[model samples]
Target: MQWIAALPMYNIAPALADDWRALLGAVLGRISPWLDARGDTVRIVDPGADLTAFWLRDDVLLSQTCGYPLLHALSGRVQLVATPAFDAPGCERGGYRSVLVAGAQAGASSLEACRGLRAVYNDEDSNSGMNLFRHAVAPLTSGGRFFSSATKSGGHLASLRAIAVERSADVAAIDCVTLAFVRAHRPELAAGIREIGVTASAPALPFIASKRVPKGLVDALAAALSDVIAQDEALAGRLRLRGVLRFTEADYACIDRYEREAIELGYPRLA
Candidate 1:
């Protein structure tokens, strides 16, 4: 059977894109030997691919999905493989936080100071990009909104650019890991953006398999990732693999709680 794989969420810093692909390819390559059926290559889905649709496709063998989407948009549609642990700031074990950022010229020292600024986000379904950031801003929102205007930047890196380069927005919430990667590898992109605050932590983006895949294959794939972490220190270092943790549906339910809390707190939506 034909299958596809993607890690769109963490594919920041174009310079390191090939390295990331190779690392994923190696992990998947290691797992292929145990499966009766496997693809010789991992199809790195491009930016244009509709990722929500891609996640629901039956042929998706491995892909990383945000916790918010997994709980709100993709519940029961995919099976968790494992959660990647990154050795980056704002990341703890298999959980990560969102970094609230503003343009250097905006002059907002903290989240509270940016009361009526324009806000940008990658997507509404994104945990780090939207959900967590919304929750962070909820308490500060007096009315239905806090931002004077909100725009969708299409992706985290783009959201960063919208604030720092395009100057179209004053603030945005970026995935901490993505921000960390860009700072390390593509410092130019992060030049004018300043991280002023952080959102609450939640389960990291999860590696998932289509439900159509057999349980045995899924188990083997999880084991393969573990083996890669244990045996290939160099590859794991490149991927920033700390350890893969098996997260349950309950663990993901915490994401939904964040949404509910935001609603109950009177800021149901990010302003």
Candidate 2:
């Protein structure tokens, strides 16, 4: 069995390694031994080596992901295994939102008020920071007049910092998950920022696996995750993962509406 775990190539903290090991050991188990016990050989691939192409590949066994672009990229090749949607179950039902934050001095009360101001986003492919930001502001702006400029800060924390410390951008939209994680682990980072508005909610991040994987194995993995969350307090504290919610089968088609609407509004730059 060939299993690969994909993670973003950003400035994630070193402590994430311990979290990964714990998750793999607890949720995925020793893949080789687990598979060998059932007559298979397992190989773990850290495809962060080539994120863009790696995510687009069809043969990889599993990848961790969230929201539209990734789903749009890997729709037919994978299935949802588990996700953090429980925090906002309505998102899975198609009504999730993202919070928009601005610098302490911006005094922007509404999306329209921030027009012509600088902005920062987590990533081009990020749904909360990009797609939803597009969806929220595209309809309300004229061509290239919405913001004076925009920067890709790579991660939510970077975006927040850009707005709060560097004063490079007046506003940013951070995914609620990343925001919550930062608050729990690094509240100082959020010190001078305040939320002005929240975009319509969308689905949370998901753990995905190849469609070829057995249903029983997937269920086992989900059960193991629940066990890990229950048994390992330190891992839970480190990861800040509330709990594993069962996977719901959703496809890129669901988010295509947002993409199309955004495009129609003339914000065609997908990042």
Candidate 3:
């Protein structure tokens, strides 16, 4: 069967789409020899495809996924390979946090000040967009909810527009790396949004392979991922990719903890 790969978490906007494509090409280039030796072929898929269906495909050779779905819906179906380290704020040691953002004119000084405002998020399954936002708001809820209403904006950039440009919502949680990318590539949009705070940290989104890929190939991919980032300074700087960290399923337990903590606090959903 043919194998597919994508790095779809942060490339919706036209400004940074080419950067993601460059990063994907660099990583795949590093691993091509190993794949060729195994008589394997890999193809790049559109980052704009329906993410949930794209992720679940049996022929998945590599992809990046949020920690929330990896621990919940995607558990057992995908194999963890390595975590990409990023240079953005709220990111360190291959772990990341969700950046809470409001409109540039929004005067909410802190998270608590944004009470009862409409909340926008990317997806229910997204860690940075929903899960981390819930965990942050969980302790602030009065009647099992914090926001006056919740709206699904489909993606982080869309959520940002809802807060900054469209003015339909007052708050949102975006992956810090994606926020950094926006600030660099699409400054106009970034300038309209104000970051209020960051959520608790979880392992960054990880590179994953389908269950069919063997252990040896997974290790090679991880090694190549690290080598490419460290040595390819141009690509690394462009993407803000710092380095890589190979991890097992155990390294991601804290993602499960984030959800559990939210449930314990009585905020089961991002309402």
Candidate 4:
């Protein structure tokens, strides 16, 4: 049997291959021989791609959610295997909050003070850098006149750089995960920046498998992950995956609630 897994590339750690191998080994166990006695071929798909193609592929077994929109799109179509939100025995809930970061010299002290100031988002499809920011500021505007201007920075790291270097935007909303990654690996770039505010806590990324997969295999994989979290100290620290939690279902309706609230308040374009 063959299986495919896709992960996001944004600030991905350099130890990704080793991490995957440990994770797959723990999850697949003796079944690994059946997969490939010599080696199992794993293919990674870009998280930014329109994942509808991967979701429709019969050969793919799993994919990770990069943001809420992608998760919403896949809800009814696939089986949600595990999520950080479930707080599986070894997994912890709540990672980081999106922050409104401004240049240290800009002198803006609060969200209200930044009005009429330019803002940057990672991407239109982004949940933390886009949707949450839009929803947060929507109620403050009457006719979509919140920010002076807005643009997509393509990725969270770019959004951070845009504010730090070009000073093009007075502020930018960036995910906490990206911020932590930058601080850990590129402290120089992360310096001279301050967080003005943080968005409400939301669920973290989820690990998912297709519903078409056999239930027996799914159960075994889940058990394996739980075992690794409980017994394998090296694997746990490397993957940062605490444990396997029970899976739950959520849909576009949850996302629609936020969009609807923003639209009703007259801030439809993220201002």
Cα deviation of 94, candidate 1, in Å: 0.9
TM-score of each: 0.93, 0.80, 0.95, 0.79
Predicted structure 2, TM vs. truth: 0.80
* Candidate 4 C-alpha error for residue 229, in Å: 3.7
- lDDT against the true structure, each candidate: 0.82, 0.67, 0.85, 0.64
In model 1, which regions exceed 4 Å deviation?
37-48
Question: Best candidate per TM-score, number?
Answer: 3
Off by over 4 Å in 3: none
Indicate the worst ten consecutive residues by lDDT in candidate 3.
Answer: 12-21
What lDDT tens digits, residue by residue, belong to model 2 across residues 131-228?
A: 88888887887773588888898788888888888888888887765666566656776887887888876656666666767777667656666777
Poorest lDDT segment (10 consecutive residues) of candidate 4: 85-94
By descending TM-score, how would the candidates be arranged? 3, 1, 2, 4
State the TM-score for model 1: 0.93
Clashing pairs in 1: none
Q: Which wins on lDDT, candidate 2 or candidate 4?
A: 2
Q: Tell me how far the alpha carbon of residue 89 in candidate 3 is from the true structure, in angstroms, after superposition.
A: 0.9
